[model samples]
Target chain A: MTTISIIGSGNMATAIGTRAAKHGHAIELMSRNTAKASALADQIGHGATVAALGATPAGDIVIVAVPYTSAVDVVTHYGDALAGKILVDISNPFNADASGLATTPDSSAAQEIAAAAPEGTPVVKALNSVFGHVLAHDTPLDVFVAGDDAAAKAQVAAFLESIDLRPLDTGGLGMASVLEWTGILLMGLARNGAGFDIALGAEVR
Target chain B: MTTISIIGSGNMATAIGTRAAKHGHAIELMSRNTAKASALADQIGHGATVAALGATPAGDIVIVAVPYTSAVDVVTHYGDALAGKILVDISNPFNADASGLATTPDSSAAQEIAAAAPEGTPVVKALNSVFGHVLAHDTPLDVFVAGDDAAAKAQVAAFLESIDLRPLDTGGLGMASVLEWTGILLMGLARNGAGFDIALGAEVR
Candidate 1:
């Protein structure tokens, strides 16, 4: 079983940790708030445990499930603890008010996180497209994975499949911007009654 | 029958004009290059005709299908001729290399087209997401429509249905930026081997 560490106790982190535990993977939930993380750990049961933010858990995968504004700071706080591990980024940099697209021209939220992580950390982008409701309900949603490391991507793909979700490989790490922007577009579609509950995955005939 | 005036002689203009004609809508192809427009008109056959750029054709809808850089210029050149008509903007402000998204932080290609059109012109955003290959092949594709005018949106929806394409109403003119950004994201997906031939449309079960 692949050991996994989740670096946030928010909705996404909880969803991933619970799903990973259901797949029989060893899981660790880390956060600054010990009570919340411990509570989540209790709820998930199945060998899942809560650890402090700086705890260097021995895991092959680490999922960073923090908000876009605090993603860099969270990654920096984890520092070399994440080095040589497969780091998954699931954040979108869109503004809450829905005025316009919110990332700088030169870089995106995933890229920022990757830059903050220690060298050889192997950052992968995935799971930012599906809604939190779907995540919590364990719906069979499609997940897009993009990263430069083929082995890391394959591992994440296996983990996604274990949760009964379709994992689509969307090429390199640079393609994360497209995946991130797709979330913003989905937000607009949902706000306009186009049904945000829907998740988009490409079908090849 | 709804009269639709298309303001370009490119591949997209031809695809939309041909599909509109197939749907029994009165179609007129307007472009500075009359020869190219006439050739496309000849290809589309029935219920379609080529007209000069300056000619004022009576139509309930005017579609501006041009490149992002030229969309504003085309709308400004048409000026008051499009007054009181439903102006459809199908341009996306993506960089030439298609490496990243490039639009003004506060506005997009659709907003710029709306700003340049004559006063009282109801500008709607549609057909920006559908690929030309998909549009030309007569396959079922999804067309996203957005604008501030309800009646104008209805008219566009009717035209979309007539073409056997799904029309998703994404809401108000401000949302055009979101739709245009989707085009950029789609382009990125296509460039990364996700198939550009696909168009995103919804089906309610």
Candidate 2:
């Protein structure tokens, strides 16, 4: 069982924390709202704990669950505290209307957070493609991951596998931008005709 | 049977023409290279014919199977001749190394072609997510389509359905940019781990 530290008390944070807890992994919830974080920890139940925001993340795998706008700030706040831990970025930098990506090809949310993170911190982009409700409901889905560090990606993939989700690695951190576009693509598909409950996956022939 | 005119004598033209012909659609191959076009026509075999480049395309639905760089030139060259025909843009504006999209969010190949196209001509972006080789292999796959006109999208969707491929409408022509990004996402997936034989699709829960 792995220990996963998730920052933020948003829908994605709650979903990931609840699922990880259900899967027998230790979960550490961190949020600015201490009451909300404490409540979330209590709700998760399997020895889940709430850590003060910006305190050293207890888990080896730290998931930044805040919005893309705040992801960099949270990581910068954590600073050296996140070094040596695998930082997981699950933020989708969607524009105001959710039509296109707010991040450019040169700067994805993961890349920005990596820039702000302390040296030697491995930032991996994952789970941004999935809807919070679907993830929370225990639906088995494919999670596309991107990171510069192979070991970090492997560890995140293992965690995803433990929770009954398939992990598809799409190469280095450069692909975090592609993955961001993919987040927009998923929204476009869901809003258009595929419906909101749909998940994108690769079908091998 | 809908008459489908394909521009270019390249891999995509051959693949789409061959498949549409097998599905009993009248295939018209148009190319700057008459000899190559004729060879492709002979290869398609089912009432397939070659049309002179820049001349009026005989089919109501015309598929521009050229590269993104040349797509606008081809459309602009056709001008009023393609006024009412439904133009299908399948060009993926990939950079030299195929790492990301060459076109910006404001100008996808479809949008560019649409801007160069004659007034009242409906331009739909489809068959781009699938690789040319995969489309030629008779494997049924989902084809994501985007266009401004509802009737045009419905017609293209019907044609896709007739060919035994699922048609997923991803909204209007503005979504052409999203589809282009999706094209890059697919390439990133293929090059990374999904393999070249994989196809991306929406999995509905």
Q: RMSDs, each prediction?
A: 2.4, 1.3
lDDT of 1 by residue, A106-158 (tens): 56678888899998778889998777666767767767778888998888888
Best by TM-score: 2
**Predicted chain A of model 1: TM-score relative to the true chain A?**
0.93
Q: For each model in turn, which proportion of the native inter-chain contacts is also found?
A: 0.25, 0.73
**Interface RMSD, all models, one decimal each?**
3.2, 1.4
Over the stretch B1-205, how does candidate 1's per-residue lDDT look in tens digits?
A: 6778999989899888887888788889999889988888899888588877856756778888878888888788878777778888888777776654467656777778888988778888988877876788777677778889899888888888888877777778887877776676566556656686756644321
- Model 1 is docked with a DockQ of 0.36
Candidate number of the best lDDT = 2
Chain A TM-score relative to the true structure, per candidate: 0.93, 0.98
lDDT of 1 at B6: 91
DockQ for candidate 2, please give it. 0.72
Candidate 1, which segments miss by more than 4 Å at Cα?
Answer: A148-151, A169-172, B202-205
